[model samples]
Target: MYVSLNRNTSKWVVKKFEENHNHVLHLPEHSHLLKSHRMVSEAQAINIDIAADIGLSLKASHDLLSAQAGGKECLGFTREDQKNYLRTRRQRSLKFGESGALLGYFRNQAAQNPYFYYAVQLDKEDMITNIFWADHEMITDYALFGDSISFDTTFRTNKEYRPFALFAGFNHFRMTCIFGAALLYDETVESFEWLFKTFLHAMSGKKPITKGKRMQDNGTLIEPLNQTTEHLLSPKYSRSIIRID
Candidate 1:
């Protein structure tokens, strides 16, 4: 199932940082990053059913995105088989080629499991849209296929973007997104949210961090129900009004 979002309807969706300006650092090359997260770290198929799970319609999704990005989705909610590879991912969890082995981790997995096809397509927006095949047997043909990635951009020549990271964790497994945040000095939630949602995946850990402001004007004087990220990864570090879904 494909969900399409047009301009100014649903207020939840945010473009993947790299999809727009590169916010979350989600890939293996930058896996060394200690703070952020990404989704497409490696080539994989996009789970489009995500929208259905989230109670979204193709039109509703299109509207949400169009509103969030303030643009029109030319190809709204369309499902087509286009090959895309995964891009960004988490820092601590990523495992690279074992080296010296004729068969690799991806190969073995492809040989065994059929849930995640090796050959997949990721849009410039970092969303998976296609796969080599929908089921197991057909995908085996691509398990050992040479990886091909398309890193697109000419706008970088201008100083409008910088690299950033967006991350989230589930159970014990963390996945980063590729095509992440802008590599710049000052950070913005717009960029962060983008990278955050790519690997945002399915059900998550906890509530999203909210705006830096408190509930009361003299709120600082009173005990608070929530906090921020200071010495730890708590709620206090968040600067936005509330976390974007």
Candidate 2:
């Protein structure tokens, strides 16, 4: 019967038998009194879209709908149902590969601005390990106000726990402007050296006069930058560190 029985029919039979047994035992089946949740409608679908656009989470949207007068009874859907719908929509929207989605976004940006610069590094597995990008405006800003630049790598941006490093400088307007940014696979000396090289390459081999970076720890902070700075200060590079503290 496991393979031959219709699942819906078997469930119905079991439910009916239980109800009948409850009746025979003078027990009330409270199922009839329980409220049934309603299905989402077209209007609610539009509302969901708006809510998603506004960055509301599934649970937040569901709670918002439930709090409205007679909303839960009229909409009839629970938070889990909304969450399921959101998952379905997201899956459908991301029909292509996840990697393609990010690369496509960058491609679109480059299409709009021809001067956008970007570089990516892949691991041994050929998966994206690091990416560095800077726009033409940032390059222009760096040319004008690249005297003092700062580097900081204290944030983790993904599940891989990669450190996000930002190369920023102050513009003529005295505004903190980003020259370039990188995601390092690790905070090792090797990774930092590569990032510094890549960042210089992105900025057309222009090294900042004052390269200030936040010191997070005794070992990890200055050593990597110092090594890279020393390498760049070589006569071949024609770059020299005026001061180091």
Candidate 3:
């Protein structure tokens, strides 16, 4: 999914080392920092909300995401662009060895700058969803009066391999996702359709906060979910919606 939430959340497991004199005997040589060269889900020993409380800024990033172009609920991806991006990433993944050192290096950067976050939530049935966030855009962009935001979402083929992400776009800036539906990724799109439909269905089930019974007749409601695309090199937040427990 590789939805670069933020530099910290991405490498939270152990990028560098900072220690106190706990004096707990036998702390391993690499104990203070991350050791494994493996990719892990966001839920691996980290809590998104707690990480936010400690100044890890995923929520802020999510907020900075633009809903300016949000019009309809599900503006899916253009097949050509998406197919190409994945093909390119896949080619790169193969060259570098899907699970190799380059990836590990990205996993251990230790600078404190404005970064983003993608939270992964789970349920008793162990279903999962992802949320993309950034502290805020590094730049300030204003929408003109009467400017509208286009909310768009894109679903790709099932994860036949390791790389799987859900993408949302605002305009030029897009959020690349890494987590959603958890193990649902393992299933073919045909089989896991129930999950995909459920997400699309989220927009179909909005609880109208203002108009009473306006959406009752259809028994369905949807809100615009805009994906803001930016020019900065900030990472993508194209994952699934954040489904809370």
- In terms of TM-score, the best-performing candidate is 2
Q: Put down candidate 3 lDDT per residue, 1-245, tens digits, no spaces.
A: 12233566664344455565556654454332322422222342233234333554433322322131141111122223233333444444433553334334323421343332222233344333222222223111111110112111333332324323332223234332222222222223332234333333332322212111111112222222322211111123332222210
Query: Which 10-residue window of candidate 2 scores lowest in summed lDDT?
Result: 231-240
How many clashes in each structure?
Answer: 74, 1, 33
Which has the better TM-score: candidate 1, or candidate 2? 2
For model 1, how does the per-residue alpha-carbon lDDT over 1-245 read when each residue is reduced to its tens digit? 23446568754454443335447645654452323332222121233234334646446654554464344332222222111111221110112221112125446765777453333333465433222212243222222220211111112212212222222222213222121112221133333333323322311222233223222111222222334311112122442222223
RMSD of each: 24.2, 13.6, 24.1
User: For residue 194, what is the lDDT in candidate 2?
Assistant: 69
| Quality of model 1 by C-alpha lDDT | 0.29
Clashing pairs in 2: 38-76
1 against 3, candidate with superior TM-score = 3
Error of 2 at 168 (Å): 1.0
lDDT of predicted model 2:
0.60
Which prediction has the highest lDDT against the true structure?
A: 2
Show where candidate 1 strays beyond 4 Å: 1-121, 124-191, 204-206, 209-243
TM-score of each: 0.18, 0.48, 0.22
